[model samples]
Target: MRDVTIIGGGFSGTALAAHLLEQLPGGARLRLLNAGAPLARGLAYGTQSPLHLLNVPAARMAWHPERPTDFVDWLRAQGRPAAEKSFVPRSWYGEYLGARLQEAVRRRPDVAWEHQVARITRLAPHAGGWTLFDAQGARAESQDVVLALGHFAPADPHPDLAALASPRYVRDPWEPDACAGLDRDAPVAIIGAGLTMLDLLVSLDHAGHRGPVLCLSRRGIAPLPHRDNELQPPAYDTPDDWLSGSDVRAWVRALRDAARQLQAPQDWRDLWVAMRARTPALWQRLPLPERRRFLRHLQVYWDVHRHRAAPSAMATVQRLQAEGRLRLQAGRLQGVQDAGAELALQWKPRGQDALQTLAVRRIFNCTGPSSRLSQDRSGLFPALAADGRLLPCPLGLGLLTDADYHLLDAQGRPQRGLRYVGPLLRAQHWEATAVPELRQHALHLARALARGHAPAD
Candidate 1:
């Protein structure tokens, strides 16, 4: 059995592996399983689109927490000039991660970086560890398993879109040419109005597709841009006070009101930063019904405000809209009909009774990954969930994780050996999406593995 079996090779898993190889006992081995696209890059940063820039600036996008400039230094050495406060492309970040992996592998010859190159269908608990079975009848065991299973394919809103179930439709936005073959003049429909939509807008523009693009969702609220980030205040020095009650609606309203009253000459974004600081304590205290309220009412606003896109990306979208090449509307897409070479979207505007149709040559699902581990379509999560090795969060942000990234079992107890180190901590941490937050979790998990401590801390 290996010392660590990282379920995903994305940033969270790979970062933790790198940290463990350096901090943990040197003799221990690391085995990584990457069913995702590229090894080092996770879903967000895995795209090859040079137009898709990171939401966060370069100053804070380092791989190591202790060494914040580690990535910048590496980039400078490789001739990627440091443009202060600029949001670099996702591909550049991927390169940095890939380089870091190479360095880690070179330094530790015994550590195994096996690109499983196959799907992990099931995970079972053995005597003192776990066994991961590949789709090809291969099984591997490890003392610890980390579910850094980054972003799964987007959740389909039109479950009965049998027309979209064909090869003509693209579910995964990161896949190349997911929007292929549409004439520049032909109309197109996008499922969600988030960063993914912005990415598609840029991609289509670059591809000379000046066609009419339609973006639709429940709220149609787009991600806000980051402006004057330096003025934003920290979420909270002691944010645990917010998570004590089962009344989620009241809590969210109180927070939103508090954010609205910010008169300290702060960036509007700081309100979100403050809210994020206390999310772990707050989410843990929320009861199931309260969490449901959060999902139903607060999820859309939180997503748009928190997960803002790069300014350049937003500008491109705005430019297109001004030129009448794009249309953003809040609607409920009822179904999709096959139109031979194109798909017709049946939708109704938000709060309107009348139905409408938008015929487009293509459609892409960017509805974000499902927050529930139990509902995860990936073969790995369900297997672990069934075995009681992993559990879902009450708020359904992701798999249940403790402070140190331990996956919880069916009985609400932290699984002793296995641990996580990515945005997987979303169930516990609010600011866990960006690299700055992820690096901290990764570093801590590595220390726990090295010290051989239980995951509850």
Candidate 2:
């Protein structure tokens, strides 16, 4: 039997595998299953666009926590010198991660490592551990399983629009040639105004599409830009009761008051960094109602401030807006209709009852991944939920997992030998998605598995 099986060879899985290699018992067998994406790259880093850059700087993006400058050092070794704080193309980082994983594997021949290009459709628990099956009926048994499934495709925003199945509609922007065959001068509409929207904008510009573009979202707030030289803010002193309070509104007020005390406006970013480290604890302290309140009212505003964009990419977007080639508006999509040569989009501007229509040759869904587990079309999740093997979070954020990352079942029991790592951990830990957080989870989970501390199967 395989000692450990990681289903999803993205950055999370790859990083976990590397960490496992260091901690797994002698002569253990390990298996990694990926659904045809390049190992270590995954959707977030798989982009070939030169303009798609890392939101974080090189120095802080090292896969190994022990070597903080690994990524930056890799850049120099590749003859592509980058400063510690430079935001480089994401493809380069993908390459760096892939190379590091390969080096780790080569250094450890005692562990049997295997990677399969297959998607796990179902999982069955057995006396030995768990049996994971692919669509083709192949199966593998492992004592432990880690679901590093990363992000899912964006869910259909509207039933009617999704039913149309028109060629003009682009459901997955990350798909190859998603922007191909577009009329260079025809107008286009992007359905969200977050980081994905910014990437799509850069892609359109790269493809020489100069047509008018419309970005529609509820808040219409684009991500703030990172400073070229990010200054480290002074250490923030947290009050003893900060995490003890259950009131999200109170926490917001406290944060705002603290931001006001910052010596410089840019220091707010550093303050956010310090606060981010404690977000998971703070989130847990919130009652369910307060958590919902934060999501409904403050999520967008928090995202814009927390997840800033690369300065260069933001500059390009600003340039396009200044030239009237791109427009950002706060609105709600009402419907879409085929208008002979183009698609007519009906939307109501924020705070206005009058409906407005815009004609566009193409519509791209840049709303990012679908977080609601109930909306997950992936058969694996629904099947697991049906079997009482996993439970979706009550707030529809993601799956419910315990402190050790063991998936909690329908009856609130942690499943032995089953684990998860990735963005979905946001269900329990609100700040779990980024590299710094995910890497720590991967490392901790690896050490736990290696120590054989999980409950017996």
Candidate 3:
């Protein structure tokens, strides 16, 4: 039996794998499986688009939190700046994660790393551990399993989007040349005007496409700018009931006050850093209703403040908008149809009654990934849930897990050898999906799993 089986090779999985190599007893075996666009980088950081840059900046993008200078040092070793807030390409960070994993693997060759390119269908408890099976008829037995399923696929678009899901439609932005060789002046339609759309504009620009591009969304809200590379220290002491089922607003107020107390040298980023340190507590406190309220009312705002655009990306977007070639339409996508060589899109401009249609050569779904884990395309989680071996978390965000990342049984009990990481943890920890948070979870779970783990719920 394998010592460990990591389901996804993305940042979370790889990070955990790294820690496991360090903490696991000698001769421990491991296999990393991922059906998505390879491991370590996953989808978000796997982008080949140079326009997509790391939002956190080079100084803070290290996979190791305790080793604050890890990424910066690596960058400098590779001839890049170590201490600067450099806006490197997303793919570069992906390469860093890949390299980091390889280095760890080299240190522990007994931990066999397998980049399984097949979808895992089910995992069942067997003997003392578990047996995992992929839809492609592959099987492996492992003492422990880590489901690092990163982000979800994009949510299915409005029914009208079906009209545009053609050769002319780019459902995903990462596919090979989704915009390759298109007519330079061909107008493009982009769904959702958030960070994804902003990045799309840069991609189109780099592709030499100067045609008009229209952005559509219910709320045409854009992200707030990061004024400068300033740090803001936490304003208040850690709350007494930080994670004790209290009001989130009260918590935010407490945080804001704490922010004001931060003196010189520390800028707004310092508050972010402080919040990052104590987020698990904040998330554990808010009960279900408060969590849902945050999702429905504050998710977008929170995302903007948390995941920002690189300075260069923001500049390009502003330049495009000023040129009028970039249009922001606040309305629902009505429909799309063939407009001869191009496509015809119909929508009602916000605050207006009449419907309108525009002809374009392409439409890209830049709505980001679908967030509901219960609605995921993967069969593994559902199979576990169906078998009563795992319960879908209360919010349907992931397979329920205990504090140690052990998958919870259907009775809301813990199951050994089964753990999860990545976006799925959003249900339990509001801030768990991001890189920094995921890295910490990976480290903690690695240590727990190494100790002949038991449920910590």
Off by over 4 Å in 3: 110-115, 163-165, 230-245, 248-274, 350-353, 394-396, 453-457
Error of 2 at 271 (Å): 1.9
lDDT sort, best first: 2, 3, 1
lDDT of 1 by residue, 1-457 (tens): 2377777878887788788667645456677787757778778778887888888878778888888778778778899887556687889988898888778878876555555665788877789788878988898888888777765667677865633663456777778767677687888888888888888888889989987888998898888887734322454432445434668767667666666766665645776676665666676677677667777988888888888778888889889989998888998998888877778789999999898987788787877665666555667778777677777765667777666677778887887667766665677665677787788788877887777723335
Number of colliding residue pairs in model 2: 0
Considering every candidate listed, which one attains the maximal TM-score?
Answer: 2
lDDT by residue (tens digit), candidate 3, 1-457: 2378888877888888888877777656777888866677887787877678877667667798799878878888888664556777888888889899889978876555556676898887888788888887787788888888876767646665665555588878777677886799988888886788877788889888899988888767666555456223335345565433478777667667766876766555555665666666777777789887777777766777777777777888889899898888788887887767878889888788899999988888888876565656787666876898877756656656888887788898887778887777876776777777788888888888778632235
- Model 3 misses residue 145 by how many Å? 1.2
What lDDT score goes with residue 93 in model 3? 89
Off by over 4 Å in 2: 231-234, 242-244, 375-377, 453-457
- Between candidates 2 and 3, name the one with more favorable TM-score: 2
lDDT of each: 0.75, 0.86, 0.76
TM-score of each: 0.90, 0.96, 0.88
TM-score quality measure for candidate 2: 0.96
Candidate 1 accuracy as TM-score? 0.90
**Lowest summed lDDT over 10 consecutive residues: which window, candidate 1?**
229-238
